[model samples]
Target chain A: MKAFTVEQGIVAPMDRANIDTDMIIPKQFLKSIKRTGFGPNLFDELRYLDVGQPGMDNSKRPLNESFVLNQPRYQGASVLLARENFGCGSSREHAPWALDDYGFRAVIAPSFADIFYNNCFKNGLLPIVLDDAIVDQLFSEVAATEGYQLTVDLSEQVVVTPGEERFAFEVDAFRKHCLLNGLDDIGLTLQEADKIKNYEQQRKAVTPWLFADV
Target chain B: MGKTLYDKLWDAHVVDTRDDGTSLLYIDRQLLHEVTSPQAFEGLRIAGRKPWRIAANLATPDHNVPTSAAERTQGINGIADPVSKIQVQTLDDNCNEFGVMQFAMGDQRQGIVHVVGPEQGATLPGMTVVCGDSHTATHGAFAALAHGIGTSEVEHVLATQCLLQRKMKNMLVQVNGKVGPGITGKDIVLHVIGVIGTAGGNGCAIEFAGEAIRDLSMEGRMSVCNMAIEAGARVGLVAVDEKTIDYLKDRPFAPKAEQWQQAVDYWRTLVSDADAQFDKVVEINASDIEPQVSWGTSPEMVVPVSGKVPALAQAKSDVQRKDWQRAYEYMGLAPEQSIESIQLDRVFIGSCTNSRIEDIRAAAAVAKGRKVASSVKQAMVVPGSGLVKAQAEAEGLHEVLLEAGFEWREPGCSMCLAMNADRLGAGEHCASTSNRNFEGRQGFGGRTHLVSPAMAAAAAIAGHFVDVRTMVEEA
Candidate 1:
């Protein structure tokens, strides 16, 4: 897990709504056993013209130049700006993996799919939910500037733009702490090992059949 | 105090709680599919951990399985796509190494994880169930608390057999009055989604109540609960009843003999108390819900089968207008056009949503004595599971479908997703019974119109959507 502190990065806006995980990284790219190297295939269907096989040279593939991420200005953009229901479909954690792999540190949306939102925090990606109007303002601000960037401060729970405009956001304190300290879900659960063990004992007593494999 | 079904299930499963309303809830069962489990197993290996309770896990490679591929035991040799074959193989290896039960391809029980679980009696009433697949909501028909979990949460549950979660608000969608003839569970759910909109049920556990829901078969109940995700609710349930018990009797995984009586005794108490309060409630008259059809890219963009598509000016909001415009363009549809008049190049009759025995019978009933339209390049009926396929075959349902020019294929989530070789090519229009209708959902540049199996079958024969009830009357 990577500890996320305050950082400024250019914003790339994806204007579509209900952008499901299947589109973020199609099922074909999900074949790989390991988590890494998904950056190239991020939005594989929307990013590339031809079919993307495992281990193919992505550089030679015809890039969907019209897509937001493939555009010249948005290149190297670490902040993703988007609309509502940003990750709805399958509960594939690969959606966040592809987003993080594509060099995004944060995703700002009016709303996000529940599972995708949860997966983002676990993978060290900051998913900030804001009011629709605030998101609209950010989109306009990014469009107005040539190299727009926003600074997200977890400790302060705010995002700042180039004009020194501050937008407050709410995050669960525990989630904020975990993201700031680079704690994944497994790591946090392990901290409460004793409690979990005690619960397991109680569960066994009530439902002993659960402990034995059939 | 009176309690809702959601409350009863949650309160029973709470192992611990915190100040912020988060609770560590015990999971009674975890269903695993190939698409989502690989990463979780990899995470387990990285963390150097084993599944907390192997007995609690049941897995099968469904989403990417080639339905026509060799028998269950033959390994990946039957699959041609290296990527898909490897994905299924990885599950086989992972399950074998970890000692988790694997229903490998060719096994009669190998089917959609959601369908197999309930049929085998692994999905019991009053239990907390989680699956990596969103359709896990299907299991909630037995009066259980079930929802989809992400891969990380999958790994968490695999390691701890519990989830750290906040309780969702309870919602009761009461459907009063009897449904008119030709309406099925699919129509009821589609109507609900249409009335509530896509995000209407977000962050709520929606319980289907009223006489309409109570009268549905177990399979029909599963169909409605299965598409709860389409309405933006992760959890959907119906109170357990005699229908649920009758369906569960003497199944392979069910508690046997004396224990079964005790289990039924417990399940009987799992329904919402009469005086229980829900945070939100919506009412619908079942007679008002006709067989439905989706005319656009989103599931919520739906209308009754007998209705005409809305004109662009009818969109209530700018966002909706934009979405409607895109959907119209992508689906090659026009406003004011009748849904029945729209042509289809293909049709699909499977998915966890509508792939049970009853669903097949419904479609077969419509397909019998009807020949498919020539314009339909392909019309396929894929069963939900191998067992479903076998039973359908024995009952001559497959013959009825085949005689009607429908390709009666084996089970698995074939063509519901484009992961497998069974998918639509560019610009193909398909009347699909699968859950989603998002852009590029079926395949890139393909158009999907979500419908019921009966509707899809009718579309296959008519080359477009038709009033299935009208056909029944004509017959």
Candidate 2:
């Protein structure tokens, strides 16, 4: 996990609604046990003209030049601008892992599916929800300007555009704290390990069958 | 105020709650599968952590397991794809090392985690269930507080047996009248998703209530709750009833004798109070539900089996118009085209969403005497689990399907996610019983029309969509 206070990076516009996890990282890539190396195949179907299989060298694959990330203008982009209902299908954590591995630090969208949103925080990728109108403006700005950059300050919960315009966002406080410090949730939960142990003991007495081996 | 079922389930599972409204909810059961659990297990090994309660977890490989008997003959070694084999092997190795009970590939009990859970009585009323897969909501059919979690949360639940969470708002999707003769839970849920759109249930726990829901069998109820994720709700629930108790009665893991009576007594109280409040309520008439078929990528891009592909002019906004246009391009269909006229190349009648015995029976009933159309390249039936396959075979359902030109295959997730060898080819169209019709969900560049088991079977016979109700009347 990586700590995040702020990041200033180029923005890539994904001008579509309901961009599902399948489009983010297709099911084929999910076969890997290890999480890394997903960067090369992020949005494999949309990024390449041909089918993507694991272990295929991605560089030599024909590029879908029309894809937002494949275009030269969006090269090396770290901020993703998306429409409503982004990351809408599947609870594959691979979606977030692929986004993070693909050099994206944050995603700005009007809305996101719940599991995908939760998964993003877990993987140290920031999913910022803003007003639909604001997202529209961001999308427009990124399209009109080449190499558009935005400064995302997690500490202040504001996204600052290149022109110094700032837009505020809301996030859960505890989640914010975890993001700031790059904390492992297991360690945090373990601090209250005694509480968990006691609860299990009490639960065992009430639902004995649940504790019994099958 | 009277508590809703969601409130009662949430309250019962609370180990602690902070001022921020984040509750440390104790998970009573955790279901694991190959695709998502490996990373969590890897994380555990890296951290030198052990699972909080060894007995609380149940694991199996489904997502990447080959479903063909010939390919699966060697068991894990028979899996052809090396990458997929490793994932299944990793689950086997981790479960062996961690001492978690697992139903290996060849085991009759092994199947999709959601199906295996209820069948084995690993899921029970009042339990707080979490799985790395989204369809874990299927367990909520037993009146459990169940939802999907990501790999990180999987690891967290593995280590602490608790999840850091916030309460979701309560929603009631009440279906008032009786469902039509041919309507199944698959039809009702798809109709609900069409009405709600994909994001309608976001941030809320939807309780499928009213007369119609109460009327469904335990399997039908499971089918409804299973697709709650497609409706944009992570948790979908049904109140406990006689069906729930009856389904759990003789299961291997269910409580026995006096304890069973006690459990049933407690479960009877698991329903929402008569005056319980809901933040949102959606009233639907069951008669309004028609056999459904998804025409486009998303599950919500659906219509009645007799309906037509939506015209771009019908889109409500620029975003919707663009989405509709993209769907048309990807699906290679014109606006206002009748759904029944859409030909299919293949048919798949299996998925966690509809692979239980009831679903298989419904499909078999349709395929009993009808021959699959010549235009249909292939039609396959992959039962949900080994038990389901055996039971179907005992009933001679497999013979009926085979005689009708449908391949009777072994059990696993199969083409539902296309991680295994079974998948759709580019430019091919399929009538699938699986949940999602998202682009490439079945295979890259494959177009999928989501339908019920009977509907899928009917499509295979006709080589196109047809009203299953009409077929029943003709028979």
Candidate 3:
């Protein structure tokens, strides 16, 4: 996993709310458990009108002109702005994989479901929670401008807009430390290896049956 | 000080408190399934470790197992899908290597891990159960502190007989009084979600209490607790009662004679005290609740069947209004349509959430001697487990379902969330007893309306949503 700090990227705004994991990547694309190759199918049902077929010529298809994703200006966007209660259903880890594969390094939303938010961190996608007012400002600014860009400084905990508009966001101290260091939940657990080993040894002595069959 | 059932269960499981304010908790039972176990077993192998408590762990294959016999062997073989096949093979190998008990494909005990664990008596009161599947909270019906964990956490629990975690604040949700004649446990849960919204119980462990809960059968209690995640609870529990004890007696894992008396004595203490304090308390009167059906994508978008579909402007918050608008556009539902009058193209009566024998019988009772509507293309009834299937067949529920044009299939998670081949075609609307009604939850672009099994059956016969009580009265 690469651990480079994200600095600046063009913004891609998804205006819809309650965009579920199923829509992020439909169940048909989930045939392979391997986490790769899902990025192309991300929003498969929405991006294509015909099932199992990509947008015909990427031009003749009935383009959902209103969809921020279908807009030409947001191509190669790395930052995603979304509404509240995003990623609302099923604990499919593929949702994050699709986002990451689609080249989105960070997601800024008013709020997110617990499971999907946690899964995003594991997959190296930074999900920044902001107040609703800040989210509304970002959405308006991006919608008004032709090509909007935001620079996220992880080391400084700041988001800088195109005209040097700087906004600060708060992250849990521990989670920030983990994100900066690119450590996951397993990595955090492994940090206490000596303590875990000692506990195991002590536990084995008390409950011999636990280790007897092993 | 009085203690709620949540506190009692938490206190019993805590081994020690670490310096960082997290607790070292001992797990009484660890359930495993094929989908999430392969990676964890690979992690264990890489670390050169063995399970600390082999006897406390049980494994089963459910997700990838095909519901039809023709596809079963073909599905299990190293097919084009190498990852799923590897997952199944890894479980088979790991259980044999570790000497842990397993319920493989074709095994009578093989089903959804949550369903199999309880049906086999592996889940008992006061036991802290951990499973890799999120629906593990279904086991909380036995008064156990059951919750799901991620793959890495699964490895940690296997390596050590304990888990590192923080305690949750307690919430008591009391639904008192008797349910109206037609309301089922599924309706009660959907109603609760409707009232509380989807994110109502975040970061809380909910203890479902009061006379209404105590009166439900064990199967009904499981149905209610299974969807607790839909309301954002980490866990949902009911107090141990005589019904709980009766369900656990003489099963494979239940303690024998002498130990049984001691276990029962211990289990009796799992209930809450009369004056138990909770951080939050929400009460609902069961008599006022009606049979519920989801009109939108999220579980919280449900309303009583007697009510009209909610307009976006009627939503309480801006976010809620946006959600309502999005659901309206996606579902093609008008704001003023009565929930009772919406037409349905299909009805599904199976899932980990509501596929037990009781659920099947409930649907069958409504479908008996009544043909499904000509406009309804497909109506399916898939049982949760082989045991449930056999029992329902022995009771002639299968014949009734078939006679009524419902496709009775083998036990598995069929059309619940579309993990299997059974699915709703695009743009189709269905009355489902499954936990979720999210966009394409049953199939891509398929609109789902959540309802009880009897309601699903009734809707199938009527070609639209209908009250089951009216059909019951006519019958």
Candidate 4:
């Protein structure tokens, strides 16, 4: 995981709501064992006219000219501006891997699906939740400006727009800490291994059947 | 204040709670399938960690396993697609190396992880279950606190058998009144998603209670809870009952005689207190529900079979109007177009959501004396697992399906995710029993109308969406 402090990058606005994981990274692309290469097929259905297969040359694929990310102004965008319920389907972490792999450092949305939201934090991709009106304002600003960018400060917990508007967002404290430090969740949880074992022992004593090997 | 079922399950699973309200919730069971587990296994190997509790994990190669008889003859080697074979083979290798228990591709017990879990009694009441697949919420039907996790969290749970979690608000989706004839849990859940849009249950663990919910069989309850993720809630619950106990009675992983009694006694206490409170409540009359079909891309873009494609003007907000407009263009349907008038190229009657024995029986009942319409290119029934396949075959349901021109294929998640040999072609419309109708879910450029098993079967025979209730009445 990469540590996040402050990321300032061009904003790409996906105006539609309920932009599901399938739309983010389609099911066909989910076949890869390695998570890193999904960047090429991010939003495969919307980004490319041809059906995306795993090993195909994505760079040579015909780009859907009308896709927001394909537009010249939004190229190399790191901040994704989206509507409500972005990443709404599937619990595929591939969705986050694709976004991160595609050079996106953060996503600003009115809301997000629960699993996708959690998946983002694990991958060091910040998913900032602001009010719907605030998101609408950002979307408007990004669409109106040619080279719009937003500064996402994880420590400050604010998305600073180009117009000098600082909109604060809420993130879980533990998640914030992990994102800021780029901490491995496994390492953090393994530190409390003794506590977990104690709880397991007590639970076993109360319900021994659960411990039985079948 | 009395505790809700969600509260009871959450309280029981808390290994440790931090000041920020994130608890280290102990996971009692995990179900792993091909697509998600490979990456997690890779992560574990990179981190030099083994599964914290091997016995707690149950795995199968479902997502990418071919359902065709010819393709399945040689087990993993039989998978036709190279990429899919690698994904499934990775699970086999990982499970073998990790010494985790698994039902490999050829194993009769092997199927969708969610289906195999409850069928094998690996998922039991009061246990906290997690899977790499979102449909893991299906296990919550047994009063378990189950939800989906990402690959990173899958690896996290592998290294430490606990998930960092905050408590979710409780929402009760209480369905009252008797459903009309031929109504299934699929209908109820689709209705629920329609009543509460896709994101309605976001941030809440929804408890589905009331007479209608209790009236559903264990399989039906599983079907309802299975799509809870489609309803935007990670956890979906139904309190413990006689049906739940009866369903788990003598399964392989179930407790022995005395331990079974102990387990049952504990499971009995898994329900919500009588005076329990909920953060939100949604009341529905079961009688009001009809066979549902998703007209558009999202699960919330659904209506009864009798309803039409909603006019753009009917969209409550500008955002909704855009979504509906996109759906209309993609689905190739006009506003006010009748669902029944929509022709289908294929019909799929299997998935973790509806491939259980009961679902198979319902589809078979509808297909018994009818031929699949010539306009329908294919109608296939892929059972949830080998156990479900054998059960359906023993009941002679497969014969009825085959006689009706429906392909009675081998058990796996065939066509559900299009990871296998079964999938829709571009511009093809399918009446499918799978959960999501999202764009390109079944196949690239494929249009899917989500339906129940019976509805899908009826659609196959009719060459279009027809009311399953009408077919039942005709019979």
Interface RMSD in Å per candidate, to 1 decimal?
Answer: 2.0, 1.0, 4.0, 0.9
Model 3 misplacement above 4 A? A1-7, A52-66, A154-158, A162-170, A184-214, B14-25, B45-55, B73-100, B159-164
Question: What DockQ results do all the predictions give, each relative to the true complex?
Answer: 0.56, 0.79, 0.26, 0.85
Q: DockQ: which is higher, 2 or 4?
A: 4
Model 3, span A43-72: residue lDDT tens: 877776666432225345565565667779
- DockQ of predicted model 1: 0.56
Report lDDT (Cα) of residue A87, candidate 4.
91
Put down candidate 2 lDDT per residue, B133-173, tens digits, no spaces.
Answer: 98988999999989999999999999998999989999999
Q: Judging by DockQ against the true structure, name the best candidate.
A: 4
Better of 3 and 4 by lDDT: 4
> lDDT by residue for model 1 over B214-299, one digit each (tens)?
99999999999998888888999999899999999988888886667877888899899999999999999998998899988888
If you superpose only chain B onto the true chain B, what TM-score does each candidate give?
Answer: 0.98, 0.99, 0.97, 0.99
Quote the positional error of residue B31 for candidate 3 in Å. 3.0
**How many pairs in model 1 have backbone atoms within 3 A of each other, for residues 3 or more apart or on separate chains, i.e. clashes?**
2
Task: Provide the overall lDDT of each model, using Cα atoms, as 2-decimal numbers.
Answer: 0.86, 0.92, 0.79, 0.92
Q: Cα deviation in Å at residue B451, candidate 4?
A: 0.9
Worst 10 residues of 3 chain B by lDDT: B75-84
Error of 3 at B395 (Å): 2.1
TM per prediction: 0.97, 0.99, 0.90, 0.99
Clash pairs (backbone) in predicted model 3: none
Task: Compute fnat per model.
Answer: 0.42, 0.73, 0.16, 0.83
